[model samples]
Target: MSDKMKKGQGPADEEQNAQWVASRSLMNVGSLDESGYLNSFYRQGYNLSKCLSESFANAKDAGADKIVFEDTESYNRIIDNGRGMSRDDFKSMFSFQKPNHSDRKSCGISGIGGKIAQCILSNKKTSTTYTFNGDEYLVANAPWDRMFEYGVFSDMITIDNMNQYQIDMFNARTNGNTGTIIEFPRNDDVIDVIKQNFSRNNKDDKQSKMECVYNPCDMINVVFGGFRLDISYKRRDGEVEQMQMYDYFGEESEKYYDGKTTRTIEHYYDARKDISRYILKADDVQDESDMEIPRVGRGYSKDPRKVSAPYEGYIKKGEYVAVVGQRHYTDMDEEPPETIIQCYDDRKKCFYDEQFEEGISDHRAPLYRNGQMIGKFHCSDVKYTNSRANSKSYHEIKSVQLKLSYSTHCTQDNLLDKCMGIQQNKNQFQSEDMPVNLTRLLGYIKKDKATMIYKYFESIRTQPISPSQPSEVEQPVSPSQPVELRQSVEDSMTQRSVNGYVTGPLTPIQVTIALGINIGDLTLETLTRLGKDRHIIAMFNAVNK
Candidate 1:
């Protein structure tokens, strides 16, 4: 540092400077622009309803037992009686890098979930008042107007800045000093943008209750249907509406079954796996006279909306529904398996009954992390052709139209580990176990002869009723009405009918094709042995009759 060390420079300083320059030369340093990042995130399939979900998730994490949503003509407010934050935590809410929660059972893992809501919905000037443990009240103001101007939300204020009037209002709304209130002015531009992205019709018509809360399905769809907290919405008209777990939202034109009965079955927790399974069973008696295959109806078109009832599909006499859920207790130590398989039904969309809509999707089961729904899970990675209602996989899942529901929770106190990787914005999560879970669920239906699913399939296989009530006496098929029996190997086999029944050896493929039995693991010899089964023979004969 002779020329460079004219001042107070040492050999150690020169060596350190050389290393720094060498390191800088070898690597290209890059940084993320907050404004550009946010703009790009919004453009890439980011659902605006997620803003509402993120807020609800934060409220739930704070152990809020009640949440109130109020939408007025000029502003929208959310009030919650949760354990509000301290001054330091309140200020951090506006920071781009928010702190991650320590509760493993939390619905939010990404630290930015709460901040996203504040950033995306903070129009003009936003004020948030909160009190922790019945202590002094504090308020923070976010001047979002300066967000893009400076490409940062740094110019925000957080302190015990609430006036007497603001404190009184907060106490009035929350009924307690330990609570939080977030209020923002109504921005029609943001609302219209959300509507244009999510609405099926995308028309700028008058807002309905379904379209009121940013048009993400409805208020009910904003959160998990089975959310434990008491949620109430104060309408713009001043009418307060309470939301129940299983409120039916069907239209008048849609069909409703009055004969459905529901029962909950709590499964024993596995000590080794630390998982508990719960079943919500919905059963209905089928009327043979009304036996009609489920078909896609109107209201699904692009132009004129003629909404049809969801799940107008056939109802078996006594079959179980399907819905799946899970909760995490401890952190995940190991990486998920690399192989991921999913199932799909691309033909038409399937909506669930209100009782089982903890989550909903077109076809795949809703995938939930902790209590929050992140995405959907399929049976296989590749799309399975469901055009044939008689396909083994499709019929097994669709015949009963079962809404399979199960949940898992952790009792310990580890927050760093997680069973799933919930991606940013929460559109998806790492679901490596989904395929295995779905396959096991289907196996439970087939392997357990004691299950109603087994009994229902057995009923269909053994008896061939011709639009008549089932009877003990097996009557001959009516010659006037001949039902064609289809085969899986239609090209390789011939169809023959004798004595109102098909008399032939039932191959494994034929059994799977005709009776929807999975024969992947069974050998030809194993299937030949099953052909001797009177029930298998009866199933084959019943189909032709």
Candidate 2:
């Protein structure tokens, strides 16, 4: 053949050579430095619990009923009896922020939860994944450190066999079951970083840390944040030992629940088009008094002329029902000053109380979407201005802690589906899409329920003396007595002094003065007799000038 003809080569040979070059280039792309993308996109709130929760969620999604968290001398392992990933799934695991499966019922919607967990918890460049697929056990070694350093997804290695060490551990722990084991080499740095980020300095942070505890044996009655977490493991000698993880809240004060109220709200609204709707079923058991569940469609109406008319545009517009019950803990003697409202999804994933800061103007009743708490809302349907004191939204959320359970049925075709504004984290409802009319209805329900609760407690407080006991008589105060004596007698009858300071019973004039206004017309005695109601306090401040 001529020299030119030989150099040109056969068409088949040229195509093969080009294909090889393209394959090499794809490999190079896999190995490129991904640190920028990882840092910018994947570095979410890096807490140990978040990492562990994600791991648990992954296990649960994979159909794992039993999970074991073991810390060994060489590495930390999260072993689960879930169906192990296939080769394709194993490779797809490294894809950033992209989930292979989108199951609405699962806690891990974004597939990056595990990746984020692993990146934040592992110090080394590699993590070992061992999965069994019936006939053979497969091992995939992910070079995550190298991926972060070189910025490529191609450094991972997979094989059909495990090293002697892995085999031994698998035999000892899983007894050769078909499952998945994720191993991260012991890294104190990762642990330290997690602790630093999750330090319990605030109420929300403390609550978040508490929400991470999981018990594999009892999935239904899992406690969120608590004083103790029991972990069971086999000792070197083969005896099983149970250990506890303690001091989860550090220095934060622990809350005790004396009463609980479980409420179920089921509502649906159709405004020509399906405007907004919900079907809620909750069991509240946290209050000392009996709950008076309002009539669903008809009882909420206020018009005397239309007594039978459904509470206009409220629960009447749709098919709604709620069953509420309250119970006080018999062990507790006195009511707790502050009530605790804990919100959980159907999956038992706890929504942190902090999520309520947004959208919930007063944080009275936390909002829920498909069982996960989106946020909290004011008890009343009023908005407030800084100078106006009370535009109706100002109420202490802690006064009545309630577990509001409901589910949203917003399909792809529903208007609510178009407006359902859930955040990527699934922790909050976007305020822009929050249905005001629905919220107002809920607020009305909670407010009325809370009023009844207060009234019940007030009745208890003002119970008349038993007929068996002799009633005490009060002598009238003489006007001739010294001003201080007369004032002191009246104060003793209405208010009590704790230490040297008078506690309450502030009069309108006193409220005005307390609100930084000089009430020139009223006497100090009259001002001192006013009750410390929030509305009165607000009115005092508003009209003080």
TM per model?
A: 0.53, 0.51
Residue lDDT tens for model 2, 1-545? 54643565423457775675676564544543455656643445445545665565567656676666665667777787877777777776766556555534444444566776776667535777788756566787767777666665544555557778777777676777777888888766544423332232222565545543232111111111221223344322444444322211122222212122334444445565444444333334333222222334633222111123243464322222322222332223443211111110011111332322222113344444433334444433444342123211122123334434344342233333234454444334455555544444455455545455544543343332122322232332334545565455445423322111344555554433333334553432332332222333233333332
Each model's lDDT comes to 0.45, 0.44
Best by lDDT: 1
TM-score of candidate 1 against the unseen true structure: 0.53
Where does model 2 exceed 4 Å of error? 1-36, 42-48, 64-68, 81-92, 95-104, 133-136, 154-164, 175-179, 189-396, 404-420, 426-433, 464-545
Q: How accurate is candidate 1 locally (lDDT)?
A: 0.45
Q: Which ten residues in a row have the lowest lDDT in candidate 2?
A: 338-347
Q: What are the runs in model 1 whose C-alpha is more than 4 Å off?
A: 1-32, 37-45, 123-132, 188-223, 246-362, 381-388, 391-395, 399-421, 430-452, 456-545
Q: Residue 491 of model 2: what lDDT?
A: 52
Q: RMSD to native for every prediction?
A: 17.8, 14.4
